[model samples]
Target: MSRAYGDDLRVLVLAAGASGMSARAAAARFNIGIAAAIRWLRRERETGERTARRQGKPRGSHLGVHETFIFDLIEGRWDWTYFEKVESSF
Candidate 1:
């Protein structure tokens, strides 16, 4: 996936607004997409900041919360025959 434009590029794009350039024109001038330029300008107008927004929530394992319980279950299952029976049922 492509990364977001940097703060410097954002600032330059927004400066077009101050010079009375339309979002579409600015985007064309900078060779960026019109939607991106419009979104960035709107963000700066609403939040008064030109920095890139954080993308999403931090990464984590789905099984992390049950790690200890899963380990205990594995350790408690002493017989290979029990595992084979469970696998066959599934």
Candidate 2:
């Protein structure tokens, strides 16, 4: 699973740990299994914040915004006159 998934699971676990609901109630509310909810809550209680982040390995698309492209644009990649006109309107 990805780090985002772990973060989501941690959020669910935190929801379960809060005083407003039972395991089944939490599971149904979140559309997860009761067993899984209990397990995650237990793991969070036992492991602390370390369990909320990524583990084991990396996989999937490495999509990211390129800093160089941003820098070039900031330094005037598009026509400076066009940007100047837009900025003046703002």
Candidate 3:
């Protein structure tokens, strides 16, 4: 999906600051959320960027730290239905 608000809306909100308009007022004027207007204006002040940030966790950071060990165990003991003997192993 695409971003709901574009750079043009963000620019309008930020520009409203110079005209003594509050973020809340700008948000209502643009039909956007108040928090969104504040966040956009703040981003422009701090980073000079008026676009939404990239979402989600970054690449190459997997949760499977022990994946290799688990695969090795399965490959080395291909004949084992050992979970039946040691239920806790599963």
Candidate 4:
């Protein structure tokens, strides 16, 4: 299934609303649809943490530090010119 940006935003809003105001009132203030606001409130009640996980520090960099390419680009290597040209071609 595809991602729902609206649902995600509603979840965030719901969480914030639960902390500050009544779910119905907060949802009404935000002008979110009534059904969606109720759904969000129920889902939050069911799960303390909504869909996404809390991000934490990872063991290592996924890209592993592309130092050589970055250094070459910074130092004005002639070979680097083709990279930009190729990127533009796409």
Top TM-score prediction, candidate number: 1
Please say which candidate is ahead in TM-score: 2 or 4. 2
Please give the lDDT score at residue 89 for candidate 1: 43
How does residue 72 of candidate 3 score in lDDT? 77
Q: Write the per-residue lDDT of candidate 4 for residues 1-90, one digit (tens) a residue.
A: 434436567766776767877767767777766665676677778876455432455578654587675565657645556678458446
* Model 2 misplaced regions, further than 4 Å: 1-6, 49-90
Write one digit per residue (lDDT tens) for candidate 2, span 1-90: 533445665586576667667667777777777886776666766776425444676775453455665456557645567667457545
RMSD of each: 4.6, 11.8, 4.5, 10.3
Candidate 2's error at 75, in angstroms? Answer: 55
lDDT of each: 0.82, 0.63, 0.76, 0.64
* Model 3 bad stretches (over 4 Å): 63-90
lDDT of 1 by residue, 31-53 (tens): 89999899888887898877887
Clashes of 3: 0
Q: What TM-scores do the predictions have? A: 0.60, 0.41, 0.56, 0.39
Where does candidate 1 stray beyond 4 Å? 56-90
Better of 2 and 4 by lDDT: 4
lDDT string, candidate 3, 2-90, tens digits: 45677677778888965889889998898989888888877777888867777666666463896886677778776668664256356
The lDDT-based order of candidates, best leading, equals 1, 3, 4, 2
Native-vs-model 4 lDDT? Answer: 0.64
Itemize residue pairs with steric clashes in candidate 1.
Answer: none
TM-score of 1: 0.60
Q: Give the TM-score comparing model 4 with the true structure, all chains together.
A: 0.39
